[model samples]
Target: MEEISKHTIHEQDIVEMILSIGKKFERIVLRGAYEDILALFKKLKKKEQSPQHYYQEQYDQYQPSAPPIPPDSAELFDYYCSFEVHDCYEQVDFEGKGLVDNVYVPLLEKVCNIHPSLLECQRKRTYKYSGWAFNALGRVSHFLETTKLEEMNVDACECLQMLWDEVQVFGFELSWLAPQVEFALNMEKFMREVEKLEEEKKTIFMRIQELRMKFKEELYFLYI
Candidate 1:
């Protein structure tokens, strides 16, 4: 039997490791490594090929004849849980933390365990954590709501503001990733329509510029 070295990985280990890392990392690196990891997986999937043999000329232009159906139920549950968190946080319900504790945390744990993908993983984690943080901060705001202006401690308010700012930062990052992924997927479709290539490219570029301007001018203010 061949000894497994530190750098050598068995096929199943690779999948589990990819899934585990998928939960923790930022998107850029996660996406950048996708093709190589996928290639490795393809190799492992074939009975006749060694891991390196899968990338040779014999495997060139090979494609899966059938596309796998996306697991919609799991995706839908994550999205629903995410929306609930958003709604609860925005409503400024001081007891929103209860909902987060009972609902959002479990959703987050399940999503992480499933390791859906980087975009969804980051979105779920950020949404749940940010909602919980925001809800806690809201409770602090409620406390200050009842306290006389003169009785409020500057330090506590400052700390709460900092926590709120962190939540906003995470929310902004999560929101940006969602639209960016949408743009990427749309770009793929747009590129495929050869007859409309020039026009669609122009439209996509223009829309991207518009999104940037709106994000800077409108969304920035609201979050701040």
Candidate 2:
């Protein structure tokens, strides 16, 4: 118990020291701080309740349990192939025709744009998990590079490769300057659309097969 208390005190002191140094150099970006913060985040995140335990506890207590998701359409997940979606997805040369242009590129760019913003707390910066953006950046880059083009899901929901999960905690900012948080919120909507599109695509292809079969049968009866 005494050892645990000492560790907690040490953690608290370290967090305070970091925040103090960051604030002292608020207008200037700390050299190497960005990379350092990014590297330490994994261990920091493992700390009992994170370096922002008190802040998070307060945040959770006051904040609403959930945000209401607005009604939406999946128009953004559009595919413009002259060929049917089922056929496009099945063909070897399709090369993720629409997904590369629309979803993957945009999502990658969005992740790339987020930065740790260490020590330059001009106006709307939150120091909570200060360098978490680096994790998001790395996670996104790895996911994009490792995922085969032919097998890439537009909404990024591959079995163990869920985009959201890959970039969850530090990926989204927990502070007032939540650039990543906005992206994270947008992902929620994207996943919901994925669910809708998957079902619609399945049904549309089934219907297409049925109609083709019907047309063939009618022609055979008429001609024969």
Candidate 3:
């Protein structure tokens, strides 16, 4: 029974260690994404004024055929939020197929274990936002490839701003996973404590056994 308990504790410890490593990897990936977004934001900000000026002029001159959809409509909002206006001058396609698959999808699957509907909503939102980002980045790449230096600066600023917005939205959606992550972290800590206690118990048991042996030997000597 003692041996079985030890084996079970050892297996639990291994599982907890693996989970700790997985959490660390997730945090590292998130930090990398955050840094990338910050760099992109700074790059766009430097050239953003030019594109804003041009867009404002265009906005003032253009007439809309249809009124904009209300933000409260979930389906419409999701579609609108994910919408990307593809530029004709796009030179390269964005490789977005595996972006969500790499992290968000798997994370959502884990979250679904806690709340399936919440997971579904978050998953949809994540994909929409990430898809918009992919499209925006693709447009930026296109502009860089085909546009003159001045035009590239303007388009890059515009596309990068769009991409930045999508990334921000994606980050917000991802934050919903925080509670689950916290719970998992707490569980890992609890498991560590359990492992420590188990070790202490084993040591105390071994000491008790040694004292029992000593008592038996003294009793035998007295009898002799």
Model 3: per-residue Cα lDDT over 1-224, one tens digit each: 33423543332233333334454334232334334433443444454343324433533422111001112332543354343333122222113221322222333334334444433433445544534433332232332223332332333444434434443442333334333223322333444544565665565446445444443343354346
lDDT of each: 0.34, 0.33, 0.35
Superposed on all Cα atoms, model 2 deviates from the true structure by an RMSD in Å of: 31.8
Higher-lDDT candidate of 1 and 2: 1
Worst 10 residues of 1 by lDDT: 62-71
The list of candidate 2 runs beyond 4 A from truth reads 1-177
Instruction: Report lDDT (Cα) of residue 184, candidate 2.
Output: 31
TM-score of each: 0.19, 0.25, 0.25
The CA lDDT at 196 in model 2 is 61
lDDT of 1: 0.34
RMSD of 1: 27.9
Q: Clash pairs of candidate 2?
A: none
- In model 3, which regions exceed 4 Å deviation? 1-177, 217-224
Which residues of candidate 1, in runs, are more than 4 Å off? 1-98, 101-133, 172-224
Ranking by TM-score: 3, 2, 1
Model 1 Cα lDDT, one tens digit per residue, 27-126: 3233334445445445434533322243234433321110000122224433433311122221222122222323233333342233334124234454
Residue 14, candidate 2: C-alpha displacement in angstroms: 67
